[model samples]
Target: MKNILITGASRGIGRATALLAADRGWSVAINYASDAAAARSAAREVEARGSRALTVQGDVTDEAAVAAMFDTALDGLGGLDGVVVNAGVVAPSLPLAEMSLERLQRVFDINVLGSYLTAREAARRMSTDRGGRGGAMVVVSSAAARLGSPNEYVDYAGAKAALDAMTIGLSKELGPRGIRVNAVRPGLIETDIHASGGQPDRAARLGAATPLGRAGSADEVAESIVWLLSDAAAYANGAILDITGGR
Candidate 1:
């Protein structure tokens, strides 16, 4: 079975992806930052699907912690086949002029730097040039990357935009080595992330304004992520897909 490690798999899209991937026959390593209980619950769901599941706890922004998470996943799952860089954070909505440096730093540190660390480690373990089997990687970006999210969390938008650039560049850089890199930009998905951003109903409110007329579920986004990691998308590389329901 293919082994996949997903960062921030304790909840939201990450949790949905873990369950779906396991149901599709992939051994999963569910990584979470602070919610050990949630991570274990997700792992139980994975195991309930008859696939191997492991819970790995670590702060994605910490270099040593990231390395340890990957190490534990590799040792537990036998080998790595794919990874979903899904860990990210956002602060309360504020205009650029009012945004604090601390908020920006925390956002970029977890979204940009964290993604870099996870993708780098995945490359080290999956690059054919390094004598390991090739693999796929999916970065969970946001539609804010393109829409710019002007007055609301522009810093988060900028960080996701960096991931888009990295997806394009890394895909080409690693293509020859048999690795595929892609990103999914989900818009106004119904998840607790909005609550953390101090807007518990943001998805429902903004989603009504979208072309689809409603908010998306975590499962909807998870479907796209898992498909990109599967062989069915063998020809899809360096693609930044928008799962915004036509928004």
Candidate 2:
């Protein structure tokens, strides 16, 4: 079975991807920042799906921790074929003038910088030069990147927008070496991320704005992620898949 590492697998879309990938027979390393219990529980679901599962703990923003997490995960799985950089945080909803530098940095640190750090390490380890299979890296971005969420959390949108730019560059840099890099921009997904931004009703409101007139489930986003890593997407590289229900 192919081995994949999914960051922030303790809850929300990351957890959903772990379950889906495992159910489809992919060995999963569920990385959690602080929720060991949740990670273990998710691991059980993976194991139940007849796939190997390992629970790892680390902060994606910390280079040393990220490095160790990937090392431990690869060691447990014997190899890695893919990585999903799904862990992120939303800055509190506020006007740009009211947003503190600390808040902006924190959001960028975890959402943009964290993905960069983790993806860099995953690329190094999973590169063919390391006697491993060339792997795919999927970043979970947000539609807010394009929507700009100016009235609420522009910082959050900017962070995701930066991620899109990173994926574009990384894809080109690594594509020649057989590594694929891509991103998923999900819109109005029913996830706890909104709650973290101090607006638990944001998703619902945004959903109503969508052409589909409903919020998407975490599993819906996970399905897109699973496909991007599958052989079915062999020709897909550096693709920015928008999962919005027709914005």
Q: Who wins the lDDT comparison?
A: 1
The worst-scoring run of ten residues by lDDT in candidate 2 lies at: 123-132
Clashes of each: 0, 0
**Candidate 1 Cα RMSD after full superposition onto the native fold (Å):** 0.7
In order of appearance, the predictions have TM-scores of 0.99, 0.97
Residue-by-residue lDDT tens digits, candidate 2, 1-247: 6899999999999999999998889999999999899999999999999999999999998999999999999899998999999999886789899988899889989998899999899878877776668978899999989989986889989999999999999999888777899999999889998898888998898799788998999999999999999888988899999999998
TM-score of 2: 0.97
lDDT of 1 by residue, 1-247 (tens): 7999999999999999999999899999999999999999999999999999999999999999999999999999999999999999999999999988899999999999999999999988889999779989999999999999988889999999999999999999998998999999999999999999999999999999988899999999999999999999999999999999889
Candidate 1: where are CA atoms >4 Å away? none
lDDT of 1 at 146: 93
Extract clashing residue pairs from model 2: none
What's the residue-level lDDT of 163 in candidate 2?
92
